[model samples]
Target: MEISAATMDDALHKALGKIIKSKKAISLDSTKGSNRELVGVQIRISDPRARFSRAISRSQLFSSLGELFWYWGGSNRLDQISYYVKNYRQESEDGLTVPSAYGPRLFALRGKNQIDGIVNLLREKPTTRRAVIQLYDAEDLDSALSPPCTCTLQFLMRQGKLNLFVSMRSNDILFGFPHDVFAFTMIQEIISRRTGVELGEYIHSVGSLHLYANQQSKAQNYLAEGYQEKVPMPAMPEEDPSAAMLVLVRYEREVRLNQTLPAFPCGLADYWLDLARLLAIYKCYKKKDRETIEKLKNKMSASVYEQAISKRAGQIKWQTIRQEPLNFTSQD
Candidate 1:
């Protein structure tokens, strides 16, 4: 079924409610755990565009964008992405890392640069329908510790606008849906800008869009919170989005290695610098240096500064909750 709305939250709310009405119950055993959920649902988010992108884990919005952008720039190092996204990847056999990370294939390291080529295709022929990036590897079906949910991303030009269409093999609508939209739409925005077309709809066609039993209640609460309140995330400046992404990647690398922030790159615009500074401020929170974070916060956009502070507070709260012993088990 298709649902249209101005923002992603409302569309997601409606989609979840529809799943409750229309989905079949099933259980599937997988790496993370057994998922007891309503299954076999397809969702098309009519307005998948973000105002203030959100995930069940709001912090994930920033982190996933960082990781996806890092990978899109043709870097396949999962450790780099894992550092930002907090996955803590365990090295794999055959000198591989993050066994199923999609970046390497997305850029076509095995064959061709699918993503970069896609940009060129759209730029050269706005009507091209063959602009595709393949992320799924069939060999991983049997061997991967964590198989990819996303199978392919298809970009289409319809009526002079660039639209993003993605097909996923499966999705946990509660925890995964928000982050998926957050990152994919950012991908759409970048491609749209690079192709010099206005951004259009985001069409998501999933084989199974389900809500695990564990997240059902919280998902309902999110619906009750509503989507009228909107926050705007700044769009990439008209200059090459790649330039800004590169700066962000460099800063993330330095922070990950415990190195001091390097001098800003020459010729990089303040648009990119603003984003890099946000990442730096987030690193201050990670280092638990409140003094540094305070000074950095003053340099950020008010909207961005507020988000960084809120996320930092949430991180502290989550860490506190994790430290507390379980009431029933620990008593023994």
Candidate 2:
């Protein structure tokens, strides 16, 4: 099954519709319950920047950014990622780290940085087919839990655009698909900028594209929302975003550790500063510092993040209410 769409949201809706309609039930030894499956599925996204879903239920904007930073930092530590997606703790073996984390595989696999290698490879030879990043290694087979769902990624420079091809062993349509597209496409754009080429389409190929039985209702709700207006994320600066990314990572650690934020104008462009501000907002949300969150929110330059931040703020408020101690006095 092949599906092509302008954005990830459209592709997700289409794929879910197909799976729900089929009603073919199958169980996996690795995961519990039956799942609706589509074998040999391929999807192409024309505009990778429109990666975030517009659906309110699927407002995974915050988690997606956390995952991207996790991968970029080349870390598999559960403490860092579990905050964003608590379920990731289940994938970790000893509650410390995930063995199959793509960060290590992509960056330090056998002591080689694939990101740098790929960028340099494309610069040296635009037409080379060897620009591939291997994620699933032979040693991963020894692990009992959390083998990589993705297999390999190949880059092709065609017609002056950098197209990315991703091969996955399996992809969970509801939880995994959106995050994968966002992170991979972000990498694609980063490479495109570094190579001074136009960003191109993202092609994702999966051996099994599936929706678990437990998540069917959620999937249905997403489908019932109808078509979402496509909202593309702001473009990255034309220059290499490596420096900005480094600064973003530094602030991410600061926010995560609840440290005082460094002075602004860290010599970064506004595009990157906005991302740092987003992280600060996330920290404020965690601390229940609504006042500071409001302050940071007003400073964001991009309007695309407004909805997600609003949603998160609501959630935090609800959580605070749930945690507040209630005193019951009998007035009878």
The sequence of per-residue lDDT tens digits that candidate 2 reaches over residues 262-285 is 445457877887877777677667
- After superposition, candidate 2 runs with Cα above 4 Å error: 23-30, 259-265, 318-332
Off by over 4 Å in 1: 20-31, 36-59, 87-96, 217-221, 302-305, 313-332
Best model per lDDT: 2
True-vs-predicted CA distance for residue 75, candidate 1, Å: 3.8
Tell me each candidate's TM-score: 0.81, 0.92
Lowest summed lDDT across 10 adjacent residues in model 1 is found at 323-332
Best by TM-score: 2
List of clashing residue pairs for candidate 2: none
C-alpha lDDT values of all predictions:
0.65, 0.84
